[model samples]
Target: MKNLIILLLFLFVGQQNIYAQKTIKIWVVRHAEKDVSNPKDKDPDLSPLGKERAEALAKYLKGEKIDSIFSTNYKRTRLTGYPTADKTGLTIQTYDPATHSELAKNLIKNAEGKRMLIIGHSNTVQEILVAFGAQKPVKELTEDDYDYIFELTIKGDKREVKVDRYGAEHHTKE
Candidate 1:
């Protein structure tokens, strides 16, 4: 009878520890399409279609409990994350694309058990995945590809990554 009580106590404590280590969900995406009409402006903002796509992205993640939003110091990236940040009532936090490894470490530390959204460029999306210790290498997104959504789930020492599509259907030419 005493052994049975001790076993139950051990089981309860183990379950509590398991519950304490919650899984972290990180959503990654490239910035929306930019307007290249102005040649002089080095940092152009999102185009009309880009704005619409941003709105769709916000709607897609509206139900999610996004704890933080990260974007580069670029206009396009900031605009892409603005809608979601506004919806979640969280301000956009800027991160340097040059220091992706450090950013990944900080994200893992601060965003544990929380949902985070990151807006980056096509060139940097793959690097972010690699920084998070993703098993598979993500291909560089094409210039016209703005619908890719990379979902990363981190639970303890295990990490899983899945690619999804969001916003309007992008018609790629063969």
Candidate 2:
């Protein structure tokens, strides 16, 4: 009876560990710099510096197990996420910027236990982070800020968020 009880306890503990191991990590960042030369163009592409920053982002996350990539339909967001998508051989999925909450819910539900990347705009990054139940209050990114990376880790019912910077330092003119 003692041995049987010990085995049962071990099985229960192992199952808990397996459940605890199921974690989902999301990497979110604002889109790289945009080319503002064409004022009439509503959707401008990334500038040269943005391209280099995108490459740097790809190199930084090269070894991460990114299973999925999400970007808005706009050119700048897609371009920012393109390098990483290309490197990981995963097609970039477009999400509607208008329905950020729904997108966040769907991603958390459907892509649970996976690592994903989301490329968004300066205004939307903080909104998405809030949707993920992030504890820290992340202010809206500035127009010229392109180096912030928000990492959201969801382990079961618990969530952890961290803000980190990547790529070269971008100096804005006063």
Model 2 TM-score? 0.91
Instruction: Give per-residue CA lDDT, model 2, range 1-174, as digits (tens).
Output: 999999999999999887764788999899998899999999999999999999989988989989999999999999999999889999999998878889888877877789999999888888887888776446557877798888999876688988878888886424
Number of clashing pairs per prediction, in order? 0, 0
lDDT of each structure?
0.87, 0.87
Per-residue alpha-carbon lDDT of candidate 1 for residues 1-174, written as tens digits (9 for 90 to 100): 999999999999999997887888988899988999998998999999999999988998988899989999999999999999888899999999999889999877777789989898888897888898886445457777788888999987888999888888765624
Runs off by more than 4 Å, candidate 2 = 18-21, 172-174
Error of 1 at 66 (Å): 0.1
Question: Per-candidate TM vs. native?
Answer: 0.89, 0.91
